[model samples]
Target chain A: MLKATIDAEIFREAIEAISALVPECRLHTAEDGITTRAVDTANVAMIAFTLKKEAFDTFKATKSEIGVDISKMKNIFNMGGKGDLISLELADNAQKMAVSVHGYHYSITLLDTNTIRKDPNSPTINLPGKVVISGEDLNNAIKAAAVISDKIAMGINPKDQTFYMVAEGDTDHIQREFGKDELKSLSPVEARSLFSLDYLRDMGKVMSKATEVEVCLGIDHPVRFSFDIAGGNGHVEYLLAPRIEAD
Target chain B: MLKATIDAEIFREAIEAISALVPECRLHTAEDGITTRAVDTANVAMIAFTLKKEAFDTFKATKSEIGVDISKMKNIFNMGGKGDLISLELADNAQKMAVSVHGYHYSITLLDTNTIRKDPNSPTINLPGKVVISGEDLNNAIKAAAVISDKIAMGINPKDQTFYMVAEGDTDHIQREFGKDELKSLSPVEARSLFSLDYLRDMGKVMSKATEVEVCLGIDHPVRFSFDIAGGNGHVEYLLAPRIEAD
Candidate 1:
């Protein structure tokens, strides 16, 4: 038996959005494991999820710790019957997890919850430069690029006081500019990066709830965007692999 | 110069959603004398699309018109550029439309606009019964069924006060019952029908923004769902052919 308290709607929405793109079902037992992978037919994307084990209750050691189908589990979670608290009970001899959300209860059996190995080769570059901007601005930028190109090139030049996104295709091109006034603050440096449009779109889908987004970037490096929600304790950090374009 | 104002966003959204599904590029003009098409994929998905009369937008006043690529037109319309008011001006001696949305202006050359005739057939027969419901509820029910089955059976019985959605597949089966409590009202008789889940999903997508929806039904007959949005001034209706069940 397990019980946890969380910002119900946000958590459910985030999980639902991520599960739509992720295909695998691997739940890490560690509280700080952070990133998880759920793969599907089209492409595999990483979901960086953070939940303090303290958010849960009734501490008891269980012999069996398992992963559940992320998609189905997310669907059941989103049905939301319990309210602020979510309760999970695993039948003693069965593979099903009795999940209760708000007041509604659903019993969903596990469809194979094997643990997925982490991508060790994934870059761990420390990003020092950051900027804060409106979520709407960034969301629109990503969405616009999504139409013309599959990769978005982001450039921030503090000295020049400009932020730009350029999406170029063989036939059409789109460029958007955001000035220094729109930025919360800028760390001085000329840094640019690129990332896949699909991942950016996925991140934008969930992060649309945030009014302000903190974006950290470095040239030829992974980009991290953090969304502060649920009074700051609840946070979602998205790390996207940069696409290096040859000059 | 070309400019048009559509009063409601719901209409634009519905038209975009429906048009995205159909591959045909050209549409008959309001007078049916001129046929027009936009070459942008995004604009095709959006309403209030405008293009300069060019080799592409050229339609047969008494001659055959060019056929434009639909996919591209849909993109520009979806960009939702600043303007609720749209204006389009032709570039003299050039095959380009200077499009304006709000203050945002962009010049786009036409690819090819073909005047194609559309054969739209509305379902015949007066449905014997009707049900009124919130579009949100219906969309959710169909979405749930879509996850489990490709085809769903919808049965309405006013006599017994029941509306049922049943979907059966090799591995999964779902039957959802919406009684009088869930529905605003139901006028029923001896009427039941089956339809493709794809079509239902599309219909639901088209009516996603609607607050209240009216569903007209008849046994073994086409189903019609009408959305009354923004105080009934806005109307969107979808008629779908029925799938006769073996039993």
Candidate 2:
């Protein structure tokens, strides 16, 4: 059994973060909070999100796992106005969830977990390069790179003490660098990786709303983005594998 | 020879009005103003637009005909910001037009007039039923009808002195009525016609910005929508042929 009431904006932010990588997820709910860890179908990206009890106006639940359709949740949230409160309730062993927002009630049938991929274990790796920057600045770099190329390379310049993003087109290229003065903080460890713009474009949109995001990088390794939501009560992390660079 | 400088917003509005119906047009320029009349490729809808000299900050032109690619003009206008001044210059008998906006200069090759459709003559038909209403309201009705059916019926009830729009779906229907209070004015002549929503949906979007739109109707005849642009200095009329109602 679970019952929760959350600010509409906060709930939308959480659902949008998860929907960026996967259409469905197996959400685990407990007395303390709710969490989900899922990988995209292509295995190139994974998203892990946690919303603590503090994120909600009221929360109560027993330890349980339920299948959620992230896309359906996005649709329902689209009907809500800013500052609206959303209430959700699910009875023990029930197949349907009740959602109420803005005077509208919706009964959504939960997807069967048996048909979804099992949650994958988070990989263990060390990324020596770390940088904390404003989410708007990071998203701006992603958008600028997308205008010129389908792939972007991100790395740290230890000598310059700056984080740099570069996208090379057949005849044109764009490069942007963020120095210590521009970033909240930076660890200038040598790191470089190429990533597909398709994934970053969608991820950038969701990250744009965040105040600050921590980006971790390593040579030819996955890139990880971590940020806080719901005024620090919730957390979201995105891990995206690098694309092999072509000679 | 022609030289003109106009507000970017006014220019964008004119281009958008023409682009909604046709990709290319034979534009007529005179000392008084500029005008264009053309039908869509499908020949089901026609657009006639006029922008008076009063709409421009500076205007000088003689009687001339120029073929314009509406799509290309739209792309150039995309670079302009609100209230920006745009300048256009063309030499007599020249096939290229120079357009400058926001410090950027673009030389566009004009389409050959011989390749474009000849100006269509405005049909001589009396539409006894007329109603003047807010453009936003009209656009809203068109959008609401599109949700239920591919066609919508618009008519005036002489007895009730009301204008009504209706769309009937296989399982449902929607009706919206505008009375004297809601409309600026009404002729209250009994008239009804079924029109394809495809054309109206596109035209409605452009019309929505106008403060007032005049809708003229007739039984089994085409519908004509007239509105002012450029703060009353310019005018646009859209005539859409009716679709035969299936029994």
Candidate 3:
């Protein structure tokens, strides 16, 4: 059993983060908060999200697991205005959840948790390079690179003390570099990886609203993006596998 | 020979007006200004436009009839920034039109005048009922009606002293009424005609920017919309045939 009320904008941000990589997730609700961890069908991206009870205006819950259709939730919330307050209620062992927002009430059938894949184990890896930068700057660079190629190469130049994104198209290339002055912080150990713009584009749109995003990378390894939401009451992480760079 | 420079925004409005009904037009350039009149292929709608020399920053031209690809011109101008100035040049008897905006230069091949349809003669018709309204308000009603049905009936109620638009969908309906208080002026004549929403949606987008639009109507007759652009230096008129209204 669970009941909670959250700001529409913050809820939208949380759902968007999960929907970016997967269409659905098995959400675990507990007394302290709620969490979801899932990987994309292609196994190319993984997302783990946590929203503390403190993030909601009012919260009460018992340890329970429920399946959530992330994509469908996104569509329903779209009808809500920015200043709206969204309320959700679920009874113990119920197959449907009640949602109310902006005077409209809807009953959404929850997917059976038994049908959902078991939560994936968080992979362990050592990423030596890290940089913290404004989300707007990171999103802007992703958009610029997308215009030039289907994939983008993001890396840290230890000697130059900078983070750069480069896209090379047929007979054309685009690059954006950010020095220490532009980044909040940087661990400038040599790191470079090529990633498909398709994945980054979706993730970038959600992260764009974040004030600061910590990007972790290693040589030809998966890139990890971490950010806080709900004014620090929530956290999200996105891990995207690298694409092979063919010279 | 023609050489002129105009604000990108003003040029965009002009192109959008022409492109609304037809993709190409035989543009008539003279010492005074430029003009074009074209009817859609189905001959259900007609557009006549004129831009005066005073509207441009610099203007110089001789009597010439050139075929302009309206849709293409719209695409080219999309590259220009809001504050950018668009410069156009065409040498006497040249086949190419040089367009420069924001330091980028492009040479567009002018269409053969003989390949384009002759300018349609403006038809003479008497539309007694008339109303003058703010473009934003008029366009808003059109948009609202589009969601309800494929056709809209606009009319003036002499007894009520109001102008109104009504759309009846299969299972839904929408109506917006503007009494004398909401409209700038009204003729208050009993006039009503059904029109396809497809055409109005495009025309409404262009007219939405105009300060005021003059609408002339008649029972079971065509609707005529007139508005000024380029700060009164230019004028545009749209005439659309009424669609058959069935009970």
DockQ of each: 0.10, 0.03, 0.04
lDDT by residue for model 1 (B1-247), tens: 2223332243245345446345444433331232333222322112222221231222222223333334565665565643265443443333554544433344555544434433333325698778888888888889999998888887797677877778887798998888899989888666778877876786687566677788878888767777654344334555666776864
Query: What is candidate 2's lDDT per residue for A59-102, written digit by digit as tens?
Result: 99999999998986785465456989989899998888877764
Which candidate model has the greater TM-score, 1 or 2?
Answer: 2
Off by over 4 Å in 2: A1-247
**Predicted complex 1: DockQ:** 0.10
Worst 10 residues of 3 chain A by lDDT: A167-176
Where in model 1 is the C-alpha error above 4 Å? A5-7, A17-21, A29-45, A53-65, A81-84, A90-96, A102-104, A107-115, A119-122, A244-247, B1-71, B79-107, B112-247
Q: Which of candidates 1 and 3 is the stronger one according to lDDT?
A: 3
User: Cα deviation of A78 in candidate 1 (Å)?
Assistant: 2.9
User: What would the per-residue lDDT of candidate 3 be over residues B1-247, giving only the tens digit for each residue?
Assistant: 8999999988988999889899999999999999999999989999999999999999999999998888867754654569789888999998878777654445677789999988888899889899999999989999999988999999999999999899999999998989998888999788999999999999999999988899999998999999999899899999999999998
The share of true interface contacts that also appear in candidate 1 amounts to 0.04
In model 3, the clashing pairs are none
Q: Which ten residues in a row have the lowest lDDT in candidate 2 chain B?
A: B167-176
